[model samples]
Target: MTLSISARFAFETDQPTDVLLQFEAAAIPEQRIGKANTSLTQAEHCARVPAEDDIGERIWLRSQGRFDVEYSAEVTIERLLPDLGTLEALSPHEMPGEAVKYMLDSRYCPADSFQSFVEGEFGGTLGGARVDAIRQWIADHFDYAPGSSHVNTTARDSFIERRGICRDFAHVLVTLARASTIPARYVACYAPRVEPQDFHAVAEVFLADPTVEGGGAWHIVDATGMADPAFTAKIGVGRDAADVSFLTSFGPSNFLFSEVRVEKL
Candidate 1:
């Protein structure tokens, strides 16, 4: 399937502020970028940097004063996602080196804290089954309340609050998967049908699957359940949202506005 994305945001800064951005659809094996265009109003310097695992690129820009950004892209995604309940979890010892870092606790996703929770709530389930259960638990128990969470909000925070936005939901799923010994990472992407659509995030877990080329494959698990995996176009993967945020400013700034639109083409 193909997707069209259009995003625009503006802000004002005091000095020459350093900013990092990761907002383009990644050109990975399963997703291909057909065309992309980006424009900055007052960028003094801008360069492209590889994102985590080199799955995508981030923009490094230095600018000051009021700034405006416009980005648009067309992407085609060709992934045959399997049922999350049908995939099996792999043993930690069997995981590849690249998947090890994702299994550890991260800034936004403290996997260690959720160890007992998973063991107790999902004791009988293993592998993909446990992931499905976790996702379901979150969707059933929490509310997708916009403005309910801030940038500093973590998985533990959202757990106690029982509410958060897409980033919070993704963080919770990533934390739970790691605590369950499944290599999980956060994903930044664009998808159609997201309520009040803007930027979107989801969790991807490494699972054992014989049908794929490798012994294991990564499967998307959206706790919010708003974005379907097969139709989702991933922008990048990271330990958490911090690593894949569309914008990260280095100094004080006033965010004026942001608008995002995603649609199936």
Candidate 2:
């Protein structure tokens, strides 16, 4: 499948400020990029650096006065994912150094806090089955209320409130998966059919790599069921949304407006 994505946002500044931008579709083996371009206005200084896992790049800039950003790209996805039920789990000792950290606690996920809940709620299921169960549980119980959560919302908060946006759903999925001894990370991406049309977030878990010997693989899951892994184009991966937010400013700034469009081509 192919997708065309465009992300544009405006920011007003009283003075000069530093900003980090990360809203481009990643160029990985599974996704091919074409006709990609990005433009920044009023940037006194600008540079690009690699994002987490080298999946994408982040744009660092010094913006003065009013600024605007526009990014557009065409991406084709060629990926195949295994059935979660058929994939077996691997021991912690068998996990790679990179995967191990995802299983640990983070600011938003706080996987350790959910360990007891996981044991009680999903004791019978293991490996990918457990992951699927967690995803289904979230889908069945939570409400997709847009304004129900705020910036400081955590997985526990969402679990209790039983509602949140895409990022909140992703956070809860990551927390529950990690609590179940699965290494799960957060993902920022663009997908064709997300309602209200905005940047999307999902969870990616590390499981057995049936393709390689004694190796592990990462699979993407969307507890919100808003974005399908087969059609989603990732921006990057992080411990939580804090790490892969599309834009982060170091100083105070006024938010203007944002426009995001993703469509099948």
The prediction achieving the highest lDDT against the true structure is 2
lDDT of 1 by residue, 29-109 (tens): 998888899888858998999999998899898999998989899989888677779788888888999999999999999
lDDT per residue as tens, model 2, 73-185:
99998877889877778899999899988999998998998999999999999998999999999999999999999989999999999999999999999999999999999
Q: Which residue pairs come into collision in candidate 2? A: none
Model 2 steric clash total: 0
Q: Estimate each model's TM-score.
A: 0.97, 0.98
lDDT of 2 at 8: 95
Off by over 4 Å in 1: none
Q: Which ten residues in a row have the lowest lDDT in candidate 2?
A: 79-88
Q: Rate the local accuracy (lDDT) of all candidates.
A: 0.91, 0.92
